[model samples]
Target: MFSTSNTLLYADKLTDFNMPMPHIYACHLSDQLIQFTGPDKKSYLHGQITQDVNLLTNDALLWAGQCDAKGKLWSILRLFNFQDDYFAITSKDEIENALAEFKKYAVFAKVDIEQNKNHQLVGLFGDDLSAVLSELEIILPTENNSTIDFKFGKAIKLDNNRLILCIDKKAQLPSCITLLESEQKWQSLSILAGEPKLNNQAIAEYVPQMVNLQAIGGISFKKGCYKGQETVARMKFLGKNKRAMYILEANTNKPFEATEVEQQLGENWRRAGKLIQTSFDIDTNRAYALAIMPNDLALDTLLRTKQENPISIEIKPLPYSLIEE
Candidate 1:
């Protein structure tokens, strides 16, 4: 059985169970929340992120990106509106750097940007989520990108089977809720779901389009100017984006790390792209990763690692079509 005390420690032992139900799993995300309070919060964010902050409703969540002047992404954010105050979640490791960048423009705005450590991010996956929530008399939003208030915290519906619970650090969950502490399992599900989460290593590396942010409703070309508006707009209108995100699977003796992934042309390997994130299942010896690579590459193209004994990678289809609308 999996215990919350040590989540990843028992991952390899999952196969020993007779038939594991689609257990409700939880993991504390390496995601940090930034609180933006003051009358100018919404207006200030509108000019900084890729998504239109003005369109964010109290019941809906927005997945947005903060990019550099050149259109390269600084960090991907999940913005929430609570009680007239706006809160956004970004990579915990990169929050300090993101805050510094925001400070440059916030000087003129009348908003306060500060990290809120009072809350913790918990990710829940599996078909049992709805039933589990129902037992607590907590109802989740039926629509994707929508949110509802729960007793333990705020639940953001990612899909019918997945949710992201932003809980208060002091609140305790019911004993009926089973927690899965393994970051690997949580990450594997995210990669397989075609969700792109940026980390410290990925900051200021690629633009939103390279990671298919536009396809996931993370970018709004119709919105007013933001930091990278021109660059992002040109790529969308002029068809200038040459790279896109793709999912790949491979077998590794250990686990796959976030490194530069390469592609084979003939006998030589060239730099194809960099990995955004990766997950591994030790029981199956299967590793999954999300990588940004040239969009024009042939479907039969083969990918490998930069190591001397390169591990072969197989291409996998994304959950949604990549066609830009």
Candidate 2:
């Protein structure tokens, strides 16, 4: 739970942003792009992350997960190529852990990996996004998992209403765009879109499928071996997975945090499972979350926070389906 103490200001700025039309909105993402340079960048990353590095190109972005040997994730990432360097955008807090895992085996590979402080990630959404980009003489990557380079940044289209922009920290944002101070709106969109927002709290907490990464095309089942590939493969082919990430939201008067959700079992509540990520909206006095629970959890079932004063949240339909293509 976080607050910027600008409820009125948020409403004023985003009034049109929330309209049915696609009015543009921007916010700085609490994420960074790690640059992997050197001759073996592609081949090295190919064996390190879940997605096929060969499939990533200047024209496309790919969702990927870097996992530990047991198939537990270090961080889920969006990988792309911008110029000569291959970049992976992930939560800032997990960078060190992810780096430690990546470097252990890289001693024998030809890639040099480090955070690129020169750029910062940003999120864009709302009114006529493509038209707004065109006004600034920039091309929007219209397809999901697609990429395009513009004068100000490398844009990755997450969907019609959302995108992740990697922009130079020193560059001037076009005057046409308004940058919001708080990231709540941006984060809420990602939560609703079913994109798991991992922090240090989430490290090694789940395998990719537990967070619905495979459902989103983040896993490459047909690709050759990578770190943790054995367990990931076994879970899929052997039907060993019984849990998955799901969307949840509820109105709240004050900020609250919880690790688990409780389900009503007759006269009392029983601990269900853990909460992976959460975002609090001060404006609406509501909380949005991504929780990991048994995949068979009934859609009609409601869950309450595992706290003295519990807030109940019902399941929301994900924009995409859980079944993979």
Candidate 3:
């Protein structure tokens, strides 16, 4: 079990981002929308995604990944049933193209795939979420419960304290709240939580274990086969996976592209892993980064960037335990 260190609090500057603040984080799945309906909807998705769709009782949230034929993950999706339709939310950049890929194979299947760009999905995350919901008098559904009754799209409890409120962009939310103006604080929270955003730069670069997916209940090994099942299972059972995701906090303002190799040690660049998400808090003079690296490197090891101007980076232990031995 990983606990927040006092060093983290001392090293990073505290922000005025208080509880009940309405912070907006973009859900990239809007770009890669797959609307699965008709008689074969459940069976169709079960075969495509990494998780078992039958496990979701129409009211629960299903976290799954879409992998290429080679078993590399192209998209991570959060699937949920909204009445008669099944929505597969994936990365914005890959979703549009992923939908087309699915459509081509789904010629005989009755399922229909389309991108829902007009409807924007935002994640309202905070630790004191219960208090926020109590103030709004809208009790967000639990992870197992679907939000179809609330009519605010759907809500899922991502963690012990974090609550995800999914709402349609065009639809008006009854809750009285204003958007908080701090992107830095939100990014910090995500890093501390070890949650990586689904983006083009990081997509298809690592398997589920590389991003701590199995530790977070994203992968269901016991469930039967799905896309890339052979590779995922083989790696897990045979101890072939060597890399895992880690949250690194650094003291730098320079921008780094995700998945780009930052050369260190010598001329040869170690393509061990890729950067997931990062943000700089100008007030704190610090930046936060989520990167996936080889397990042998050892997590929480402090190091310096190999850029023209090197920066100090301290890797923090992720909240979840790695699946690799």
Best by lDDT: 2
Scanning candidate 1 in windows of ten residues, the lowest lDDT window is 10-19
Candidate 1 vs 3: which has more lDDT: 1
Residue 207, model 1: lDDT of: 86
Look at candidate 1 and tell me the lDDT of residue 32. 86
TM-score of each: 0.91, 0.92, 0.79
* Total backbone collisions, model 2: 5
Candidate 2 lDDT by residue in tens digits, 178-220: 5677788787778888987576677898899999988888999
Question: So what's the TM-score on candidate 1?
Answer: 0.91
Q: What does candidate 2 score on TM? A: 0.92
Clashes of each: 0, 5, 2
* C-alpha lDDT of all candidate models, in order: 0.78, 0.80, 0.61
Best by TM-score: 2
Cα error, residue 191 of model 2, in Å, equals 0.2
Clashing residue pairs for model 1: none
lDDT of each residue in 142-161, candidate 3, tens digit only: 45324433554566556544
Better by TM-score, candidate 2 or 1: 2
Model 3 ranges with Cα > 4 A deviation:
1-33, 130-137, 141-148, 174-176, 181-187, 254-272
